[model samples]
Target: MLAAYWRGEITLRKLRVLIQYLPEDSPARWQATDGRPFTIRDAMMWRALWSVATVAQQLAGKDKNAFENMPAYPWSKPLNQNTYGSFGDHTPEEVMDYLDSL
Candidate 1:
């Protein structure tokens, strides 16, 4: 559902409802509300789900990476170099910027 929004197949209103269905602690839920801060667990779950959405979107001919193209989901952060290793160094800013630009 979120991936649908990223791909321009859905509206922000619909995305809001989809996000609202997540657990209360979900970063996506918080982010959809007001960009509130989130816990580490929230960040981890969001990233994992984003990765899955990215793959599914790609398979559907949406070249966008869910983590790199979608709206920020509250707990989004700059990847920690020491913790995330090679996958680190990216930031939600890049993704959010792309989305806004679109």
Candidate 2:
């Protein structure tokens, strides 16, 4: 996954799919200083891939303008927030902070 990001082969839609599997508080959950509460290398990998996907989207001339019209989580709704569980709103900054924490 990291290799894909480094090679800029990811897509925004795919990136969103990856993000859906990451924990809401992945950073705080995986940090060594946070007592290694949970293992989250996979989340970190996806976050890195997301960065690459953003770059790829820009290079392909399908930048923010393309995403602006898309709904949040355009490809699919988060599983945990679907009919089985209550939905929670989170800002992009919060999501990034979680990824960075991991």
lDDT of each: 0.63, 0.53
Local accuracy of candidate 2 as per-residue lDDT tens digits, 1-102? 445655789876677677567764566434432443334454466456666777787797654443333322223453333353322356567766977999
Write down the RMSD of candidate 1 (Cα, Å). Answer: 19.1
- Prediction 1 TM-score vs. true: 0.33
| TM-score of every candidate | 0.33, 0.27
Residue 100 in model 1: lDDT: 94
Please count the clashing residue pairs in each candidate, in the order shown. 0, 2
Write one digit per residue (lDDT tens) for candidate 1, span 25-71. 56664554465756567767777887887799778875444455554
How does model 2 score by TM-score?
A: 0.27
User: Which residues of candidate 2, in runs, are more than 4 Å off?
Assistant: 1-38, 65-102
lDDT (Cα) of model 2: 0.53
